[model samples]
Target chain A: MPTAVTPSVLTRPDDEPTAAALIAAAVETMAVHGYHGTSVRDVAAAAGTSPAVLYHHFESKQRLLVTLLDRGLDVLIAATEEALDLAGDDPAERLGAVVGAHVGVHLESQRESLIGQSEIRSLEPAGRALVVTKRDVQQRTFERVVRDGVRRTVFTTATPDDTARFVSAACTSVAGWYRPGGPLDGPTVIARYRAIALDAVGYRP
Target chain B: MPTAVTPSVLTRPDDEPTAAALIAAAVETMAVHGYHGTSVRDVAAAAGTSPAVLYHHFESKQRLLVTLLDRGLDVLIAATEEALDLAGDDPAERLGAVVGAHVGVHLESQRESLIGQSEIRSLEPAGRALVVTKRDVQQRTFERVVRDGVRRTVFTTATPDDTARFVSAACTSVAGWYRPGGPLDGPTVIARYRAIALDAVGYRP
Candidate 1:
């Protein structure tokens, strides 16, 4: 596993300041008030813009949320992919890398990650489907690695699918309780989670 | 561990039909639209009552949510306590029983569980404090069990607190993906989670 792996940074093009501001405001408001609790007006007010300007950028409040959720998933997916690429051929190393990256992303993007976890129900069916599809891609990455490990006799878990799900859920939940300056630092969290994932899978080495 | 272990059931007194209806409606609506997305009017309509009646019962939407969240936590805490009581003195049995009961409650009380997980942030400070206090009790239950297991040398985890947190988070998260009529049934899910939790702690026996 890579020693210096960092979460993929969430950045936008330099030209979209107003849009960026609106997204930032939405993250802040939604983090506090939730999706149904937050309004386009609230996001606009927080962004120092009018509802008309908010509408010009995104068709509706749900659309703005969809945009933000998509971006958050993008960062998570990118980070996981980068970690896996650097993890080499051993299934244990790959599992550690992916779990590390998963924890890293959720820690670095707590609000966005929390929103993504909580507000998927708030989206329209189409938007929900879009986010679920991205989420499934990430899920499949873990599933495939675990299945491979089992096939190779490296992971002794009786239920590969369930083990993968448990590891992902355990890692995903870090966002709910993790504080930025909390006792555990980023690399420490990443490393501990990697150990937990390995143990959960009954890793041989 | 008790062979006939089951999750504690969440039941309300049959006397308060209107209040019960209101609470039930709130659970359903909040499950779909979330705490902030749900409104008193919607819950009232669903319960076949008026906003005044909802107010008479719950005082406000937040109050209704706080009530719901409190009830959910009560059921969870009761289940865990009962499981611990019946689990004998073995730390592995204790861990299995609690994880089993936790998964059982979340599966049977999916809507309430989902709402409780997502809506804690929607509570006022006093209500949030009350709920957090209850939540901490449940968390400490797991922490103490794992710590004891470590002391007894039945669990080989280097970090008992983190392992406990990971196990609880992993079990709590089953509510997010589990479906009643899905591929796995409740007992199967519970059994799988017990094994996963045991493996997570590196159980020696």
Candidate 2:
């Protein structure tokens, strides 16, 4: 179940033109029209290519979708890990770091994050299981932080597992409603959510 | 934008065969196939009726989807209000009551709730605005409670608005994952979430 997609697979290389174009077109179309609404031909047209070219790179539309989702999740995990590394020994600071990173990544990759959240239901059985397993790994990271916080008395939640789920869900949801250049900038939004996340676990600051 | 849908619209009158059948079919289909994946023909066929019959009650497929979502949100709002009424004057108790009712309502009406959350993006412009407006009103309820708690020093969050959004998002996400007859039953799930919610807002005591 640990089919950790390579981070390089997500990044567009100058050498691979078709695959890069196809991924971009898929993310743009699926983010707006949704997975079911966008067909291979629609993506192909958006990419200035043909359906045969799309099938050449990806076997089917489902495969293309799973690839996009896998890449997005991989990027998110990497960002979270980096944030956790920067966070010091304190559990509360670590929790804030995770929230800030979660919100930052989600807003920076708004379209992909939106598609990743909404289109999980569109994946086939096998794809869904793989994505769910990867998602569980990400959730475990948050759970571990919360457990450490509770053990140190820095957090006083009765249900650490539930707290992890709540914080993760809340952080991931920032992408849903947040608009860039709105009332608050990215830094402000991150700061506010970070405080809320710390407070959420009964973090004694 | 204030299309405040009446709560009674969600109830099935038993006498209204067409609308009830249509709603049931839509929920069943959309729950599995998603709003984008489902078509008017699919819903009509599932209901054992023709497209004309569906159109007679609902003007279009988009209209039907919005109607279903509006009713679902209205039901959730009413249930949350009732929970708040029973929670007495304590802000912490009120927060728990809101979370408990939120999880309970989402789990009870799983299909419609799932559709209501995931398919909101598929809504047309006017429909999206109206639904978002209605949703904001619900969020305001949580904000008001959190603000009151902060004023009383029972909650120590600097961002009451962010706390409301975080709690609402976390509670609403239960519908995305909860399965009936799973390892945890409805009451246990609700109770765990209640504790998590209470701790999340820094409720002291």
Candidate 3:
């Protein structure tokens, strides 16, 4: 049987230090230069390693990007799941928690969020499928919360799916324009987005 | 006197067909390979022209990108202005119109919208400044309507600016995932977003 590809939110014990270094370098380089503009040599040089070492760890640059995207998604999914766990069964609170976590993650990991959004087109079929599967899980998390809210009559939106997507899209966009020390701090942005998500869903309370 | 740059919604008579062809080619190429990955040679080859001819019209690849970004903004700004004109003075109607036009533009000009959103970072100081100025105008357009709505007590949101930003972000994101022959058509998506924008602002009937 083929080994399963399970993503871990935390740093894995099996992760080689050199491979981790390469992934970090790849994120930074690809964030600036984009996938097509970034070469394996660029990532290897940034990681202070040789192309042979990079190839030893990962088959190619595409594989490196897939790993980066997977790791980013893992972090996001873990954070969201934690938030949902802490929030009680109240649909409004759950919606708030989910949007807050989404905004916080995007703000804290802006580069990774940006790369995940922009570089999906650069991935091959298998890699794209992997990322899309993770993405759908994230999307469905929001949908489930919104649907629950609708079921409980706490949310009044006619289209629960569309509302969930709008909230997700709005939160995802923060990474594109937010600056760490800009006008609004992270907490303020998070709070605002949480409220906006509620408003988008037409929270009755 | 320095020639003041004015952006037009319609193609200008001064627009050389060769230059237009080059810009079209640049959008398609950069959409696929990105700005950093694409060279003047690639754009020239795509346009079926020589690098000498490309340079004759555009001083550099960066200038060509700026022109493309500027033109894209022009089209968006014009479409939005027309929508607002037809919306009358009612805040809710105006909000619906603006978002409808916004989603419509992103759907109709997916390549240009995607390029404009992604390639802003690739621009140099002057080019970035120019695009940012146009973008602020677009942003302020949404802000004004929201502010007006709040003043009239039709929208209950305390943070009109943030609500405006959220609505704009949500609408702008349509370009990233919307497919022509997907489950939802253009009119459906546009109407759904218009309603979502209203819901986001806490619009009152």
Most TM-score-accurate candidate: 1
Tens digit per residue, CA lDDT, model 1, B54-118: 89977999888888888889999999999999999999999999999888889888778888888
- Residue B28 in candidate 3, Cα distance off native in Å: 1.4
Worst 10 residues of 1 chain A by lDDT: A1-10
Of candidate 3 chain B, the 10-residue stretch with the lowest lDDT total is B1-10
Output the worst ten-in-a-row residue range by lDDT, candidate 2 chain A.
A1-10
Error of 3 at B4 (Å): 35
What level of docking quality does candidate 1 show?
medium
- Candidate 1 DockQ, CA atoms: 0.71
Among the candidates, what TM-score does chain A have in each?
Answer: 0.93, 0.92, 0.93
Sort order, TM-score high to low? 1, 3, 2
Q: Any idea what lDDT model 2 has? A: 0.83
Model 2's CAPRI class is: medium
Runs off by more than 4 Å, candidate 1:
A1-11, B1-11
- Write candidate 3's Cα lDDT for A78-143 as tens digits: 999999999999999999899999998999888888888888878899999999999999999999
**Residue B167 displacement (Å), model 1:** 0.7
- Per-residue accuracy of model 2 over A1-205 as CA lDDT, tens digit each: 0112112235555536777778888887887788998999988888778999999999899999999888888888888999999989999889888888888888888788888888898999999888888888889999999999999998887788888888899988888889887898999989888877777787875
In model 2, what is the error at residue B129, expressed in angstroms? 2.1
lDDT of 1 by residue, A35-124 (tens): 888888998888788899999999899898898888889888999999999999999999998999999989988888989999999889
